[model samples]
Target: MGHRLADTSSPARLAAPDEGIGRDELALATRNHGLPLEALRYDVTPPGLHYVLTHYDIPYVPDDTAWRLSVTGRVQRPLHLDLADLKGFPQVTTRVTLECAGNGRALLTPRPVSQPWLVEAVGTAEWTGVPLRLLLAAAGVDADAVDVVFTGADHGVERGVEQDYQRSLPIDVATGTEPEVLVAHAMNGAPLPPQHGRPLRLIVPGWYGMAHVKWLREVAVTDAPFTGFQQSVAYRLRQESGEEGEPVTRIVPRALLVPPGFPDFMSRARVVRPGTVPLEGRAWSGRAPVTRVDVSTDAGRTWREAELEPDDGRPWAWRRWHFGWTAAEGEYELSARATDAEGHTQPLQQPWNRGGFANNLVQRVPVLCLAKEG
Candidate 1:
């Protein structure tokens, strides 16, 4: 099917200068240029429109200098790896979707306190780098270690608190084969542009972006879980199931249960005669494949199946599904919810969390009916 987004000349701003870019400047780029990012997973987000969330004002790590990836802390053999050292190890490439932990938080009710993201807060890329386990194996992880801490070079002020960016992954996910983790030196086959964490960045293919720290300068193999601000204060999800709510500090790995992509017009709205339109949208599940996508027209009163695109078991990619319905002269609401193969359906509304992480509310895009003019 043909895309509805404008041509390449439309100013999408993926590789533009940061002069006019503001806290929310990317919105225009997403709406104007069909984000050119490819899903690499089932969702198929184009490469150019991937969302970037950073703590610093953007750090540029030069290519000429000899860069190093240090593995310190509790390892038996603390190691420092230069680019050549990393290259000397076996090279692995995996296509995985990377999404901000707070990707869909903007859609939450009462609005969480975090960066407001319109739907474009994620992207997938073919990451080529050395396996994280290989480095850990060389470092000889201590038998009693509990976690591995990753720190990046991006620095910024959060609520007047100046801090270096850091986060941790459990030793299991950090060392597993399915994680397909990388100390990526390149993104989409180029020395990663500085804005996108140049030189070296951690790429945990199936996990959220928080685990894939960019511009990674140091990786500490630790005996205990990390307590960095990004982990303790930010990216913490309020645990609420049915009625009880508690806060857990340990970072839990999240999967792309719902695929990422634009919404489809399930049915056309008509303010005049004979003007018909098509409905489309995207769905994904991080832990499992999306089994079905349900569309609603009369505000949850009636349900219908939207056509789902065939999917392979690619981690973090979204599925594109669509349905077509007739238009009538009236106001209507358009919404979608995805059910994973495991039967975890998106809630009509996700709960409010202090840090605004892991929000997977049913997606709704509003459209108005207007009369055609001659």
Candidate 2:
């Protein structure tokens, strides 16, 4: 696609405490779309329904035959492979749940001013491609390789750093089997759509979306850590300004409730009948499988364990949970929190970071319960 760079510097900043969303943030919002809370009901998110956050314009590939993936730098043999050659490697299809790092930024008190997502930037699908480990093996990575830098064709400027969209994986992660990264060419059994990275992309199973570079063009094995803006200056968790912040990596534990009943069109608040009602949602974690989910109908003052659906065997995919609630005619607040096997649980109050990365806060839904009369 055509590239569009920010004409001026665009850096991250927090909104005024009393302020509303800025036009710039709205502009970013228009470019990226979050998954609808209701789409959680689907086991495999339709490609069109999946959430997407493109840092730049989607790269245009009019013909798949012409695209090439080059593997170079610190390798015994450099590879220049087109689509046909990549497909020759043994293929794998993995079902993964991907979530944006800034999923709940808008809810922060002095919201960090980027991608104002409100807990809906997530989705899951089966990705099919060659395992990346195989590609590196074929390239014969040098023994001292420290990191593998991936460059996507989409170019843009961020925080005044003009460069190609890029990210790097440490040698262990790049070659590991735990997350089993993929050089994905297909999503949900079909060729990737343009916005999802068209001809090819990367799928880092447990990591947040950014690590999965889209519209990939180059893979370079390096002996040094990548200091690209996206890697070092962005996607970090800093409480204040100018700290070498913790690197934002995997997805944190989170649970979200599907609004219980019919919604009031303008306001999206739930309206339910006064009776026992079924409540269901999805929970997931990149650190481990969600072991338990707790539902709170009275604003988290009290919590009841929800029955988690038996594991479907896709560890990296979100699992479903259901709880039944007896309702009365009144206004109520609803919430859900998850605890993964690693003992990590979501916080009721969001943990803040300068870049708005990994903010896994519990969700609150305002619901009005009314009686159905003859």
Candidate 3:
């Protein structure tokens, strides 16, 4: 493959300011003192801090001069590519939602040992990049290849092991043609932010964020399955101690209700004027398309099918759903649940796991309806 240098004529955007808070403090106070959460209020795609999640305290910023992505092992042609070289290949863009594996860990009873992210840890973005399979095909994978290992630039000691962030997928999944995977270089029409993995990152549509390795530097094609620390040790769902847990893969089905904030509640505590209030939110699944969304205005006692948006056919993107409610003065406990095409549905309560991964429990919102002034 041909190699080229990236155009450096344009000035880079300023990086987001780091709050200088310790990891523990940031995790505990995320809703307020940590990264701001106001962006999550948006209906289409959340903006600012809501768009990305960073695992470590500091994000790695690579110098363009020394940065390169290498593909080796079990390939007919080993290749080294720079940013411009990757951009030279045909570019593809798609909108995908990414959620951290430990998204709802804060809600867990005993709490898991990780970033205590609530629902705000998820976001959707339009990503632009080169198809990863193109690069893999250029390398000509060996017939015996079983797994494709991805190694990121980020490195540190985790769970007593000092290693770079890495993970792998089956060769078929990595090289699949449908719902194409990307070596993404841009997010929301801009060069990726440092917090979201600048220069290059892997985007494994339909999988948890852990499978999308950031600051990607190496792709190793192997004849056997990879047993990397991030893949085999962390990000796995374990029911108890000492048992090898199932690898956290596809996202479970979930539906979120966007509450009517501030002004609506400011008039009265959790109160909305009696009228037709439009209830809306997003629903998604990694295993299959979201087939339906059910909304409940009186806890789980009564339910109504919400109008769902037409799927754009992007497997990784979420579908927006809406329900119009005409209410009289009363108190209501609103909630939403989603069902997927594969028959998987959001549960009232997700099974307790040691890592608190895949917590797709139904979300509820409390509201009081006040009669309109005569």
Candidate 4:
């Protein structure tokens, strides 16, 4: 299926001033035209309405008839699978949440560096495709294979590096039984939008968005770890000026409280009547299932356990959580934190890294508890 381009007339496509746009201005422009940065605040983000953030301005639309996914490198039998060939495999469907590695970059204390994302860089979708392991197994991975590098059709010069978008994972993780990584061709039961990986994409369940290569065209098994710019430079977190911190992976445990939209202010900052209110949002983790979620009305000074919805059995999907709060006339800082099955909980304050990646700090929203009107 061919992909459709986003309407150029959208507010996000407004031209910059003659003086040229600064980082802040560019961020605002993109936010207006691109996906809303606060999309996860809703109960279920519709697939068609899901947020879209691309590294390159133009999205690649491949002709389905001519498109093929190549598997080469350290494989015993290299193979090229067309769209129909890929669909012919035993297919699986799953609901997985994907968050940008730099989801909270805008909230970092040292000011902005990369995309100024204020936590709206995530969404959950039902993905349908063939298991990546099936393809790797068919190709017969070499005994010495170490990493599987996934390459996208999109290409652009980022930070002076002219290259196609690519990222790699250890062979075991790429073909792991759990999380069920996929060479996805459909999102939410439909052919993926161009903004997403259209003809094909790799869905690395439970990992950050960067690991899920869009516009996928090639899957290469390498004997050595791939050191592509996206892997070696861009997505890796760094501390200080020169220290290589660590490669960012997995979705950190986190919970977001959907705010009651207040009049005359952002919906996220709402005024509520002094009474009992239902607090709801979604919580997720990459390492394990979200076992517990806590809500705090007075910041982090105290917290109470929130009820967790039953897991959907997809290890990669997020859980819906809810808490009931009795409010009084006052101003309060509401916050939510989630704990995963592995005993890891969202921190009140996430330490800053040079790249501002993986900021899973507990989300805090301001609320005004007002008396009932009339």
Best-fitting candidate, measured by TM-score? Answer: 2
Backbone clash pairs for candidate 4 read: 12-33, 37-120, 262-270
Candidate 3 local lDDT, 1-374, one digit each (tens): 55322331122111124423346536545532222223434433534554455544445565754679999999999999999889899999988878777776666666665565666567778889999899999999999999999988887666556678889989998899765789999888888777678878999888888988888899999999899877887777787756799999989988887765333435333567787888888888988899999999998888899999887766788888889988779888888899999999977765678777888878667788776788
Which has the better lDDT: candidate 1, or candidate 2?
2
Clashing pairs in 2: 1-59, 1-60
lDDT of 4 at 240: 54
Regions more than 4 Å wrong, model 1: 1-44, 239-276, 369-374
Q: What C-alpha lDDT values do all the predictions have? A: 0.64, 0.92, 0.77, 0.79
- Once fitted onto the true fold, the runs of candidate 3 whose alpha carbons sit more than 4 angstroms away are 1-25, 28-51, 261-270, 370-374
- Model 2 agreement with the true structure over 256-347: per-residue lDDT tens digits: 98898899999999999989889999999999989999999999899999999976779999999999999999999999999999899999
As a TM-score, model 4 comes out at 0.89
What's the candidate order when arranged by decreasing TM-score?
A: 2, 4, 3, 1
Q: Where does model 2 exceed 4 Å of error?
A: 1-7
Candidate 3 residue pairs in backbone clash: none
Name the candidate, 2 or 4, with the larger lDDT value: 2
RMSD of 1: 10.5
Q: Give the range of the ten consecutive residues with the poorest summed lDDT in model 2.
A: 1-10
TM-scores vs. true structure, each candidate: 0.76, 0.97, 0.86, 0.89
What lDDT score goes with residue 360 in model 3? 82
Using alpha carbons, what is the TM-score of model 3? Answer: 0.86
